[model samples]
Target: MYDTILVATDGSDSANRAVEQALDLASMFDAELYGISVVDTRRYGDSMLSGSSGVIDDLSDRAEEVLAGLEAQADVGVTTTVRRGRPHEEIERYADTVDADLIVLGNRGLGASGEIGSTAERVVRYIDRPVLTA
Candidate 1:
């Protein structure tokens, strides 16, 4: 009983699984699918010592590439977005903006400490919407 489904992806193997599941669900429910890939710009903060020169531009380019690939892979029509910011924040904001009925994402690996992956965990914590992590 979903009208709009938001799928957050990072182009990782785990994310690909999430994408597949999202697509299937969208098709089954006859819901409009919205896809997004967020480029985490925080990792490339403006620090000369970090040597992250041009990192933002590079990430933007990569986001475009990832979104394009996702669009191509989805059999159903997908509205896709590429954003730059904290991954979870961007995903949550987009979901709210679209009033998505469900948010789908992958259990992309964990941080060094072995907790749930930061992005997925943050999305689950901050967004008061249904989340399906594959």
Candidate 2:
């Protein structure tokens, strides 16, 4: 049984799977789903950074939008969070803050498929909480 649940997402397909899985678990256990999306602001100054005025804000907004959609689809108790920073750091911090019984996240991110993302692996190593990957 679980109460509070947190999922780190990036609006990717795998993240969507995590949302669906989290939703199913929440419904089964009557748990509350807390969705989180972190915008890695560090990308702004990186060489790959594209020219943009509101890159950070845009990512935050997009993240919120994606989470909102998931919440709407779940149609149960759901909460959304958007932050700018390293994905693993923000997710770990959120897990601690929420004291989540379970932290559900996609093993793979928006990057390559069939392999777990580095951020997800980092979160698993750094955070002491439970993580269920979809």
Candidate 3:
């Protein structure tokens, strides 16, 4: 029985499916649902590259918007958070901070590669808790 469930989303179709699965799992287990959207800032670094002005800000804004939309769709009471960093690392860190019993994430994301996205692969590699890809 999970006490807390975390879902990492990027507003992609796969991620949305994961969200629904997480919500359903949370509802079934009567667990607290937590949502996170991470703005991948590893490429941006500390200083803005000349051509990438407002790119970080834009990503951050999109992350918040994604979280907001997820919150609206959630049937159970959900706590949503936004973080800036590599998606996999930030997600694991956040899950650890919240003591999540399970992590629900997408098999693929916006990138839509034939294989799983690096974020999901890395998260599975590093996280100690159960991860369900929907």
TM-score of each: 0.88, 0.90, 0.92
TM-score of 1: 0.88
Pick by lDDT: which candidate is best?
Answer: 3
Question: 2 or 3: which has the higher lDDT?
Answer: 3
1-134 in candidate 2: lDDT tens per residue? Answer: 89888977887888889888899889888988888999887755665455564766677789989988887888687888898778899998888888899998888888756888888899889889888987
lDDT of 3 at 60: 80
Tens digits of lDDT, candidate 1, 1-134: 99999998877777788889999999999999999988776765646426754776777787778778878887889998988878988998999999999999987732323456888888888899999988
> What's the candidate order when arranged by decreasing TM-score?
3, 2, 1
How large is the C-alpha RMSD of every model relative to the true structure?
2.4, 2.1, 1.9
lDDT of 1 at 20: 91
Q: Looking at model 1, which ten-residue stretch has the lowest summed lDDT? A: 107-116
Report how far off residue 39 is in candidate 2 (Å).
0.3
List candidate 3 segments past 4 Å from native. 44-53
lDDT of 3 at 82: 89
| Model 3 C-alpha lDDT per residue in residues 1-134, reported as the tens digit of each score | 99999999999998999999998999899999999999877666656644575787788899899989888888899999989888988999999999999999999989777888888898899889899997
Q: How many backbone clashes can be found in candidate 1?
A: 0
